[model samples]
Target: MELWFTGTNAGMPIADRNVTSIVLRLAETRGEFWMFDCGEATQHRLLRTPLRITRLEKLFVTHLHGDHVFGIPGLLSSRSSLGATAPLQIYGPSGIRELIDSWMGITETHLGYPLSVCENTEGIVFEDGDYSVRCAKLDHRIECYGYRVEEKPRAGALLVDRLERAGIPPGPLYGQLKSGLDVELKDGRIIRSADVRGPAIPGRIVAVLGDTRPCAGAVRLSERADVLVHEATFGGNLADKAELYGHSTAEQAALTAREAGVSRLLLTHFSSRYGAEDIAELVQEARTLHPNTDAAVELTPYAIARARNES
Candidate 1:
């Protein structure tokens, strides 16, 4: 999977950054993308990338801040014009449904595709055979949530050479072996799937959090994640200001990542007060606590690879 940061600035757009929008592009087999926040001019930023509007399958809103949701109406409307016929699902905190309804009602925007908006979200929000997403309350001025996406472990590849050595020709038996099922040959010989299969492929975990002060919920959602996308709305020296504003400093985010034992930390939602040099300093400050920390740059895609099994 890959996370494409369309807008990384907090509060408002700056000369270089837009706001707080991110696109989580799934694998090619999934053929879809999930969005986190749709800040102002998000679609505009998306246009500069190769991602298609039609493939946007879902949106997870963190909070109702203007900078976090002002672009939803326009993005949804544009999706219709761009020929998106597939249904779209949206999950967010309480009042999310009313907020979207008000926007659409006021604009008289009737989308061609069906839209599903889920509100008052908590715990497991989305789940299927392949993946599951969980949300937890965050310590923001307004009600906000952090999401943990856990991909299900995939079955290992079938060992064709091993099967050949066992005098088992490829066919339906190969399919059964790949599914971790024991297969009985026509000659009455049983083959155990485990003996011929490779190691189980571990799933990837990613935690994308909303704007909030560093809290236990953030740590819970981010535990051992492959990548934790947390807001660094202030520098290390502004810890008091970050607390006052219900935000997190880069140092706080790094500490959280280190505590959660995440492989990498992606710091975003930067305040406009920080310039290039200040942002670099924020990253350096974070690195003191968490060596694998990076400040998210707008429109940059960060790849999250699968974790290797300890065994």
Candidate 2:
């Protein structure tokens, strides 16, 4: 899986960054993506990237802030124009349905595809055969939430050579064996899949959090994640200001990452107050606390690889 930061700034648009938005490419799908936030002009940002608008399958809104949701109406309208017929699911805190309905109704925008909105309470908001999304309340001014996307473990590769050594010819029974099912041969000999199949391949976990102060919920959601995407809206020295504004600094994000034992930490949601000169310091500050921290650069894609199991 990969993560692309569509926008990274906090309040206003900066020279280099936009607002808060992230794009995650879904695994085992047809070039589809799960959008984390739809900040203003987010669809416009997608045009500059390789992510296709038609391939967007879902959108997860963290809060009801204008910077985090002002682009929803425009994006949905644009999607219809782009000929997206597949249903789209949107998950967020309460009032999300009203927000969309009010804008769409006022503007008379009718979506060609159906849209599904979830209340996004605490628990598993979405789950399928491949992945499950868990939500946790964050300490933001509004009812913001953090999401943990856990990719399900995939089955190990089938041991064709082992099957051949056992004199088992390839057929539908081979499919059963690959699925961890025991198969009985025509001669009445039973073959156990455990003896032939390799160990299961572990899946990767990614946690993307919304705007909030450093809180326990963020840490819990990001526990042992392959990648933890958190916000660093202020400098490390601005602890008091960060808390008052319901935001986090680079140092706080790094501490959360270290505590959660995440493999990598991606800091984002930069405030426009910090100029380009402050970029290096912001990243360095996090790195000093957690060696694996990196600031999210706009339109940059970071790859999350699966952890290898020992033999």
Candidate 3:
């Protein structure tokens, strides 16, 4: 899996950064992208990357803030214009459908493909054959939410050496064996797949948080995640200001990562006042507590690796 920062500024746009937005690209699946928060100028940010707008299958909005949702309409329109026919599902806090409907109605824009919106709170919001998404409420100025996406474990590779040792030559039967299907040989011998199959490999887990303060919900959603994408809108020195504004500082985010036992921490939604050097400082502060911490920049992509199992 990989994460691309479409926008990283908080509240407003900056010269080098836009408001909050992220795209989680699943490398195991082809043409699959999950977006978190669609800030203003999000489509423009995609212009700099190789991401296809039509591949955006799921959108998770953290809140109803303008900076987090102003670009949704334009992106939907652009997808239609580009001849995308796949349905788009959006999950967010309450009032999301109203906002989308109002925007489409006011602009008289009609979509060619289906658009579904779910306004929910604190539960499993989405599930498919390969993945599941759960939500939990967070402490913020608005009714914000954090999402936990868990990928289902996949079937393990076939033990080809074991099969070969048993006088089984690689052939079409190999495919069937790998899928756990019993294969009959020309000698009328039955080869059970379980004898040569390996153990299943566990899938990845990613947690994404919107604008919010350090809270229990965030910790729960991010617990034991392979990758935790949390907002760091302020530096360590501004803990009081971050708490006052219902946002988190670098140190606060790091603490959440440590407490939640997340393997990696990605920090974004930076305040406009900080520059590149300041962002480095923020990352360093988080790293002091949580070694696997980094700050995100607009248009930068981060690949999520599986965590090593603890002994």
lDDT of each: 0.93, 0.90, 0.90
Q: Compared with the true structure, what per-residue lDDT tens digits does model 3 show for residues 218-270?
A: 99999999999999999988989998999999989999999999999999999
Clashes of each: 0, 0, 0
Q: Could you tell which candidate, 1 or 2, scores higher by lDDT?
A: 1
Find the candidate with the highest lDDT and give its number.
Answer: 1
Candidate maximizing TM-score: 1
Per residue, candidate 1 scores C-alpha lDDT tens digits across 1-311 of 99999999999999999999998899889989999999999999999988998899999999999999999999999999999999999999888999999999998999999999998457999999988999999999999999999999888888899899999988898998898899888899999999998888989999999999989999999999999999999997888999999999999999999999999999999999999899999999999999999989888788888895633
| Cα TM-score per model | 0.97, 0.96, 0.95
Q: Give one digit per residue, the lDDT tens place, for model 2 in 225-278.
A: 999999999997888999998999999999999999999999899888887679
- Please state every model's RMSD to the true fold in angstroms: 1.3, 1.5, 1.8
Q: Could you tell me how far off, in angstroms, the CA of residue 232 lies in candidate 3 after the best superposition?
A: 0.7
Local lDDT at 6 for model 3: 88
List ranges where model 1 is wrong by over 4 Å.
none
